[model samples]
Target: MIGFSILNTINTDNDDLSGLNEIPFTVSYVTSIHRAQGLEYKNVKLVITDDDKTNMTHDIFYTAITRAKENLEIFWNAETQKFVIDNFEEQTQKWNKEIALINAIKNNK
Candidate 1:
């Protein structure tokens, strides 16, 4: 028994991958966050390449972090270290505010 796969990199001019079906055995998998919704894993390692603050929102960060059931790890390149740090600091402030609000509500109750 043997298996093979075709790694087709989509380009601006070529988008047709249907022709690959004639090759008998070819497979590809998508690990995108949108597609990973509803799936849970014991451990997850997420590596974010995009450091743009506009693209990396709190919701997106939360979604990616919450995917792991037990342990989750994150890695960023040196080029984006400052950006990552800034975002994390901002998010930490929001998290602390939320925690304080919850504590206030609990104390009132």
Candidate 2:
């Protein structure tokens, strides 16, 4: 489990109630990339196991990398590393092309 503390301020029209507060929470150490979408964290650790290679996609990898706001660590075996290197550029270009097509369609509508 990972623990987090966040400071928040409380405000009210009443003169006696405005103050700073601390909120604490705990979260699991591991979560799926899909489940983590639209959330950002101070640090992220991504592990790609041999079993993951078969189902891994560029979008999933991209999402995991982007989730880290300040630091990111990635762990994978040599085979997974090679898989990323071999497909990275091609996949990026393909996604870019798809994005352009989507934008063109939206502009025409």
Candidate 3:
């Protein structure tokens, strides 16, 4: 009922974020993006919730975007779409400008 069946390969075998040891393998495998930092795997799929750019902090977006090794997917509703487009146009200009400056510096060097 989704886009691709290949996505099933990335299905996590274990999903436990709370690392409370007393809980025994209570912490299994799949972790939310926050806890998944500094880890690596073949594929990553993120189901983005209704909360969008208008509410969440920029760091949240940054963290979510950076958590992929090879494949990264995000599923969101209409609210998420509008929030992303609106916030992207507003904030990404500065990010683009900074990237351009960095490229210019590297080129000069």
Candidate 4:
């Protein structure tokens, strides 16, 4: 059993605490990413399981990364890492070729 105690006044009869003053809480850090959106943090570590990665999209990744104010670390398996690295390299090569073409056109004019 967790060794945590609290002194809180709970009213099961009324939804509104009309005459009751209480501090009710048991644990923390139990929240979903959807609920965490629009909130910022100094550092964010996202742990992605195989199941989660299967449904992850760019928009979701963007949202998760933007939540971090300074640092963002994504923890994933080898499969996800390989996918990220391969896609990144492919996109980088395409951009490099496009930039080179643009420079050549400008120099010829």
Please state every model's RMSD to the true fold in angstroms. Answer: 9.0, 15.0, 14.7, 9.4
lDDT of 4 by residue, 8-107 (tens): 4574765554555445554435345787799988778888777776556555766777888998888999998667556556767888999999999999
The candidates, ranked best first by TM-score, are 2, 4, 3, 1
Say which candidate scores most in TM-score.
2
Q: Give residue 86's error in model 4 in angstroms.
A: 6.9
What would the per-residue lDDT of candidate 2 be over residues 1-74, giving only the tens digit for each residue?
44454334454455553354455566647788999999998989999888887667787888999999999999
> For model 4, where is the 10-residue window of minimal lDDT?
1-10
Candidate 2 vs candidate 4, TM-score winner: 2
Local accuracy by lDDT, each model:
0.70, 0.81, 0.64, 0.71
For model 2, what is the error of residue 65's alpha carbon versus the real structure, in angstroms, after optimal superposition? 0.3
lDDT of 3: 0.64
The candidate that wins on lDDT is: 2
TM-score of 3: 0.45
Runs in model 2 deviating more than 4 A are 1-28, 89-109
Identify the runs in model 1 with alpha carbons over 4 angstroms from their true place.
1-30, 50-54, 78-81, 85-109
lDDT of 3 by residue, 1-109 (tens): 2232122233466564343232223222467766876676556666666653465446666676677778877788877877776776767788899999999999998
State the lDDT at 105 in candidate 1.
Answer: 100
- List ranges where model 4 is wrong by over 4 Å: 1-30, 84-109
